[model samples]
Target: MRGRPAALLLAALLTTPAGAATLPSASILSGTCCPGTLWTPDSRSLLFLDGPPARASTGIYSVPAGGGAVTRRFSSVAFYSPDLRWAVRPGTGDATTLERLADGRRFTLPTRGADVVWSSSEARVAYARSDTTGNFDRRTTRVFVANVFGAPRQVATVYGGGPTAWLSEQTLLMSGKASASARDRTLFALNVQTGARTTLRSALGFRSVASSPDGKRVVYTVAFDSAARNGLWLQSTAGGAPRELNAFGSYRWRDARKLLLIPLQTDGGPHVLRQYDVGTGAWTTPGDLGDQVRQGDWNVSPDGTRLSYLSARDGNVRVLRLP
Candidate 1:
C-alpha cells in the first residue's frame, strides 16, 4: 500500500512538472501565403507581400492577428514607413520615390536601390550608397540623410557594413572597418547634425544588431570572434560599458525594457520563450511553444503583449499569447 501511494505521487509529479515550459498557440494563417511577414505597428494584423498564382496581383496584403478574412492593404509594394505614413519605392537606378499615404504627396531621393531608414517621427531619413566594385568588406559606403522633400546630403563614410539602425532622429548606429585592410570592425554611433561619432564596441565581426524602441539601448551578437567575444550583448546608446547577456539565440524587444529570445536549440523539441528584463537585470523562461519557428520567422508585437511566428511543422503562421 505504501508503494502504491509513492507511485501515485510520482504519476502526479510527472503529469505536472514544476514550471513546465509548454505554451499553447493558435494558427493565424495556413498554406504559406508569404515567407517574410511583418506585423503592423498597432499589432492587430500581419503584413506580407504576395502575388498571382495564389493572390490576384503583386502587392501588399494584411490579415488580422486574431485570424480572419485576408484583405489587401496596399495595391503596390514598397518599403513602408513603420507608421504606414509613407511608401518608399526604389527604382531601377539612383532615384527612389517616397509617397505620403495621406495626401499622395510625393518626393524622390537618390538612394539607388537601398531603402532609407526613417526616423522615429518619419520626418527625416538616412541611407547608404556603397561602391559597386571591390571586395565587399573593403568597399567604401557613403551614408546620407535628407529631410522630407529636401535634397540629400552626404554625412559619413564607413567601409563594410554600413548604417544598421537609426538610434534617434539625429543619430545613426553603424558598423564597419576603419580601413579596407583593418582586421576588426567597430560599432559606432554618428550624430547626423553635429558630425560626432562614439565608438561603442569593437570586434572581429558583428551580426544581428538591433535598437530599442526608445533608441536608448542596442543589442547585438558577435560570433566566431573567440570564446570570450562570442555571445549577445546589451549596451546603452548614451555610452557606457556593455553588459553581456548570459544566453544566445533569436531576440526581439518586447518593449523598451524587456527582450524576448528563443534559444538556438535544434533538438527538435519545443521552442522556448525566454524574457530578459533590462531594468531589473533578470532572466526568466516564461514559456515555450510546442513547435519550431521556421527560419527565425517570429516577431513581438509593438505593445509587447503578443508574439507571432511561422510554424516549422506545418509551414503556417501561428500566434501565441505570451505568458
Candidate 2:
C-alpha cells in the first residue's frame, strides 16, 4: 500500500494515539532464554545460539514463533547467510570457508577470519579487512567482492567505514573518509563492476544505516554533528537532499515503503511501536509492547507481518502479530 509521496514536513511522528492499547504478545521462550536470535527466512521460527547451560550443547537452536518446543536447528555453528542457504565459517587463519547447505560443497577465501556482507540474491558477497594498528578513523580497510566459488577481487579501500549494503549485484554502498586526516565521512555508492562512483552523503558518522528491500532508499542517523546535520535522516541512494525525521530511536524497515520504530522514551512507560508510511505522510501506532525490550533486541520478521523481541520484563523472547 503505497500512497502518495509523504508531506515530509511533520515535526515528529506521534507514537501514541488516543486510546492506544497494548499490543498482544506471547513469550515463545523462557528461562532468560537465548540471545542473538534471528528469524528464519520463512519467518515461522526464531534461531538462536545457545550452549550447555541453556541447551544440550553449543549449537544453533530454533523455536516456533507461536510458542512451542525448542528444536535444534544446526548442530554446528557457522555464520549462516540471511537466506539460510550458505554457511560461512572463518577458519583460525586467513581462510574463510563457504559451504552450500544443499550439497555440502565448500570453497575458501582468505578473509582473515572476517565474515562477509552478502548481496540480496546471496550469490555474491563482500568482505573487508582493516589494519589492526592505527587510529580507528584512519585505519585502512580493503574491501573485496566475490561470486560463489570464485576468486575475490579487491573492490574499494575505505578509512573508518566499510560496505553498508549492496544496492544491486554490481552497486555497493560504502562510507569512509577520503583521507586519513579528513574530519568527515563520505557515504557513497560504488559500481563494483565498472569502478564508477557516486557520492551519497558526507557526515561525521552514520548510525543505524539501513536500506529498503529494493535498495533504492536509505535511512541513517548523524549525531553530535553540526545542528543542521544532526538527526535521523532519510535519503535516496541516487543522491539528493535528505529529510530529517524528527523522531529518534531504533528503527527497522517494514517492507519497501514502511518503517517500524520503537521510540526511545524513558518515562517508565511501555515502548510504543509506531510505523511511518513513507508514501502516506502519516504515522500509525500499532500499539505498545506492554514491556521494555531487553538490550534493545528486537526485529521485524522477513514477511513484515510479525515482530519478535527479547522481553525485558520476563527475560524471554516474545512474538506479536502486526495489525
The collision pairs in model 2 are none
State the lDDT of candidate 2 residue by residue for 23-110, as single tens digits: 9999888888686689999999999998887787888999998989888999989899999999999888899999999999999999
- Computed on alpha carbons, the lDDT of every model, listed in order, comes to 0.86, 0.87
Write down the lDDT that model 1 would get: 0.86
Which of the numbered candidates is closest to the native, going by highest lDDT? 2
TM-score of each: 0.92, 0.94
